[model samples]
Target: MGALFFVKHKPTCREIDIVKLTIYTDYSLRVLLYLASKPDATATITEITEYYNISRNHLVKVVHNLGIHEFIITSRGKNGGIRLARPAEDILLSDVVRKTEPDMDLLECFNPKTDNCVISPTCRLKSMLYEGRSAFMAVLEKNTLADAAGPITQAKSGEAVYVNISRLKR
Candidate 1:
């Protein structure tokens, strides 16, 4: 009789799938972090671009989207700059991630209109991916912008706090 040994195989590249955050989302988060880090001062796109060494064209789009979403306020003309619409503690990480992420689909089956998977009708993978995505988002929900950006200074009694008035649109 001959002894048998077990053999293990590593997953091939074809078997592995990778997901990455878009540059838009990356820039959005970086902008948010920069603004949050300087709650008392406004930041300009040029300043942010220089600080991060990112492209002005791309940062402009990110800043515009942030303003449109009410995540950040923008002021034009002299002394014009950007600032967070709300306090860092008031911004939810999950909300930011959801708003910034271009797509949440983890697999082909996740989107019915574009799903071409043969197992679409009876795929356990979809359920597993949903579970995973939910778990991932749940973690973000537990945290706030302040958690990543650090605590904001508390205003003392009879002290004024900096507020971005441009973000007060109804």
Candidate 2:
């Protein structure tokens, strides 16, 4: 038999990070997409909660945070509802993610103040983790919310409808 050599393939940053988004972040994105799908129309908190079948209380916080970030415009009155503050194409996926994800630390050693890892002082792992996170964000930087929202199909009745929200989670 000929000599065989094994090759080691390192996992990508996305693979290494594999960070689970918080429910808050999930809701925030959902709300943004919902508004994006209906760019000309405003959606109320109740409408979004009903469409997604999520808790109103939780969505309230998400909506509030989105408004604070100026991602959406909220009016309070008879016509009160939320709409995108800017065009969908103007909203960068990276910006939403960075604002929503409170911590981007891939490992315990990533944060100097909170890191208790003894190996952190001389650890190459920290650098690797940072590289992974950077790689992950780099992908997000290339796309905007419009790329994610895609085309919203209008039904025969002229009502806007968007299917496959699962794609937006990415």
Candidate 3:
């Protein structure tokens, strides 16, 4: 008998990373946090930019979108600035995320219009991912800007103290 050989095919599907918020959402949250930290005062874009050490141009767009969504109120000219349109306690994190994120689809199969997966119709993975995403949103829905905008902590150098995730593994 002739020798027979078989080859196993590697999956062509890309390995998608865990769900993440967009930079716009991050900036929006940061702006809101900065504003919430100073409840009695209005903040200029320049001030916010300087405080976070982020891009002014990007912050401008974020501020505009926040204003359009009625999350924040903005005024122009001297003595004019931005302030929260509503109390931080009333602004749910999930609402901000939904409004700012252009797309929330975790996988291609999540969107039927663009889904081209051959196994999508019978895929349990899609349903599992949907459940995971729902759980993620549910957690966010339970929290508000007030819960996230706790006291600001800074280093001795007056810089934001960022957690080192790798160190936490120990």
lDDT top scorer:
3
Candidate 1 residue pairs in backbone clash: none
Write model 2 residue lDDT over 1-170, tens digit each, in one string: 11111112232332353356666677888888888878888899999998889999999888888999999988999989999999989998889888987777666566667777666678786787578668867877997887777756789999866654544443
Candidate 3 residue lDDT tens string, 1-170: 11111112212235556456667788888898788777668999999898779999999999999999999999988899999999888999889888988877777777778788888878788788778878888888998887777634699999755332211232
**Per-residue alpha-carbon lDDT of model 1 for 4-53, expressed as tens digits?**
11112221222425545556777787788888777889989999999879
Q: Which model, 1 or 2, shows the larger TM-score?
A: 2
Error of 1 at 43 (Å): 0.6
What's each prediction's TM-score? 0.78, 0.79, 0.80
- Would you list the C-alpha lDDT of every candidate in the order shown? 0.72, 0.75, 0.76
In TM-score terms, candidate 1 sits at 0.78
Candidate 2: give its CA RMSD in angstroms.
Answer: 9.3
Candidate 1, residue 91: how far the Cα is off, in Å: 0.8
The segments of candidate 3 whose C-alpha lies over 4 angstroms from its true place after superposition are 1-13, 151-170
Cα lDDT for residue 5, candidate 1: 13
